[model samples]
Target: MTSDFVDVQIANRWLTSCLSLFGRVFGEDSAHYKRLNEQFPSYPKWPNVEQAYGVLLAAIDDFEKEALFSIKQLIEAEVFDEFLDQAEQLHSSGYFQPAAVVAGSVLEDGLRKLCGQHNVTLPDRPKLDWMNSELAKVGAYNKLIQKKVTALADIRNNAAHGNWGEFTSEDVTAMIRDIRDFMCRYFA
Candidate 1:
C-alpha cells in the first residue's frame, strides 16, 4: 500500500516475469526430466515438455496472481478497492473473459494516467497498440504490424485454450518460448 510496498511488489513481479520467460521455454516439467534416473535399458523416456509448459504457466500464474492480489491489497488500503472488487466479482461470477479484460484494462488506464502526469503523449499505447500504429511510427507503409498482431492473437488463443485440444506439449513450449523471445527482442 505504501510506496515501499508498491516498489517491492513491482520488483517481485518483475522477478516472476523473468521466471515466466524461462519457464515458457524450459517448462516446469523440465526440472522433473532432469531428475529422472533410468533404471532399465528399456525404460521409457520421461515426458517433460507438456508438464513443463504447464509448470511454466503455473509459475507465471503465481506471479500474476500474487501481483494482482497485492494490488488489491494496496487498493483496499488506499480505499480505491472498487476496481479490485470489480476484477474479482467478474472473475468469480462466471465472467472469466470480462475479468481478464478488466485486468488489462486497468493496467492500460494506469499507463494513460502516468503518461498524462508526465506530459507525454504518443499516437498510441506501447505494447498492445504497438500492433496498430507501429508501422506509421516507424515511417513504413506495410502491414507488418497487422501480421504481428494476428500472430499474437493466435498465440494468445493457443497458449490459453489449445493446450488440451490442438496444442501439443511441444507446441505449447515453442509458443510460449517464442512469445517471450519476441517480446524481448521485438523492435530492439
Candidate 2:
C-alpha cells in the first residue's frame, strides 16, 4: 500500500467510533423485535451487525476521500500567509525564541485549521504532539514531515521553558525557513 491518503488504522478507528454512536442510537443487539410474539417493534429497522459494519466501512472510505479532497482545497487557499510573514520578520530581527514560537504556532494553527476543514475533532487544548499525531493518523503528511514537525515542537517547547541553550539563533533561522517551506508546501 502506498499510504498516500487513506490510513487504515484511522479508518478502522473511524468505523469503530461510528459503530459506537450507532449502538447508542440502536440497541447493542441491534434487534428490531423482542420476540416473534411481539406485535409492535422495539427498535426501528436496522442492518445486522455484519451488514452495518460493512456499511460503516464503505461510508468511512467515502468520507475519507471527501476529507482528503477538502484538505487539499483548504491548503491551496493561502490560509497562513500572514503567520509566515510575521515569523520571517521575527526571525530576521534576531528574536530567535520568539521567531521559533511564532513558527511553531503557525504549524500548529495550520494543522488545526486543516482538521477543522475536514470535520476532524481535536482536543480543547491540544498540544503540538497531539495535533501532530492526529494529522499523522489521517495521513495528512508523511512520516518524514511528521518527524520534522516533532523537532519543531521540541524547539518551541524548549524556548517556552526558557531553555534557549538547546537552540541558537541559527537553529531558529532554520526553523523559520523550514516552517515557511512547510506552510508553502502544505497550506499556502
Candidate 3:
C-alpha cells in the first residue's frame, strides 16, 4: 500500500485501541456512564458505550475515506471500478451539497449513537437536543458548542438543498472544525 494508506492503517489501529478502552471503562453503567447519560433517568433506551464507540469509529472511518480519496482520485485509481463510468459522468455534474449533507449526517448520527450508547436520554424530535443536553452535562457547550453545531447543520441543509447561494472553503472548514471540536470535547 501507499504511505498514506500505511499511515491510515496505523491511525486505525490506535483509534480502535482507544475504543477498547472505552468499552472497558464505560461499556456498561459506571461512573462515566452516569456522568454522560444520567440527566433523565426515566428513558429506557439509552445507548451503550460500545455503540458510541462505533459512532466515533465510523466518523473516523469517514474522515479517513474522504481525506484519502478525492472523487477524481477514486476514479483514476480504479478503486471504484464498478462505478467508474457513473462517477466519471458525475464529474461533468459534480455536486458539493452531498458532501455537506454527508458531513452533517455523520455528526448527527455519531452524536446520537454516542448519547444512546452512554445511556443518555435523547429527544426524538427537534434534533440537536443532544448538542444541548450533552453539553449541559459537562458545560462544554458553555463554549457555545450548540450554536456552532446548529450553524453547521443549518449550513449543511442549505447546501444540501441547493439553497445556499454561495459558500466558501472557509465555511466548510469551520463546519468540519465544529464537528471535530464536539467530537473531541464529548465523544472522544
Candidate 4:
C-alpha cells in the first residue's frame, strides 16, 4: 500500500491506541493478542508499520464511502457535480466566459462546503475572498493556496463582470484544472 495519505506519527499513535484497547480486552500476553499480531505483524517497525497503517486508513476509506453512499440515498446534493460538469462543457464548447463563471461558482460552493464541514461561520452572501480568508483563519490551507485562490477569484471576477478580454480559453482551462484538483484534494 502507498503512504501517500498516511502519517507515521499519527499511525503510531493509532496503533498504540488500538493495542492498548485490545490489551485491555484480551490481555497483553493472551493468545488473542498473539493471533492478532500474527495477522498484523510488526507493530511499529518499518514496512510492516506503514502497511498496517495503510490497512487502517483503507478500512476507514471504505467506511466513509459506504456512509457517503447512504447519505446520498437520503439527501440529494447534485449541484456540486452539476456545476463542474457545466463548466467543463462550456469550456469545451469554446464559451470561455460562461465557463469561468460556472467554474467560479463551483469554487465558491466548495469553499462554503469546506467551511460548513469545519463549522466555520461565514457572513451572509460571502464572496470568494471572504470565504478564503475564513478558511485560512481556520488553517484549512496555507498562504500559497490563498494566493492561488485569490488569483482564481480575480479571474472569476473579470469573467463575471464581462471583462472577456482579460482572460483567454487557455486561462479558463487552467482555472478548471485548478478547481478540479482543489475539489479532489479537499472535497473528493
TM-score of 4: 0.59
> How do the residues 18-74 of candidate 4 rate in per-residue lDDT, one tens digit apiece?
566546544577444454354453334455555555544554575566743434422
TM-score of 1: 0.27
State every prediction's TM-score relative to the real structure: 0.27, 0.56, 0.41, 0.59
Candidate 2 structure quality by residue, lDDT tens digits, 88-144: 788787777887787787778877876775566987898889878778878888888
**Candidate achieving the largest TM-score:** 4
User: Which candidate leads the pack in lDDT?
Assistant: 4
Q: For each predicted model, how many residue pairs clash, with residues at least 3 apart or on different chains? A: 1, 1, 3, 0
The reply for model 3, stretches above 4 Å from the true place, is: 1-95, 117-119, 129-140
Q: What is the lDDT of residue 17 in candidate 3?
A: 58
Displacement of the residue 26 alpha carbon in candidate 3, Å: 15
- In candidate 4, which residue ranges exceed 4 Å CA deviation? 1-79
Error of 1 at 109 (Å): 0.7
The 10 consecutive residues of candidate 3 with the worst lDDT sum are: 39-48
- Global lDDT of each model? 0.41, 0.67, 0.51, 0.74
- The order of the candidates by TM-score, greatest first, is 4, 2, 3, 1
**Residue 33: error of model 2 in Å?**
58
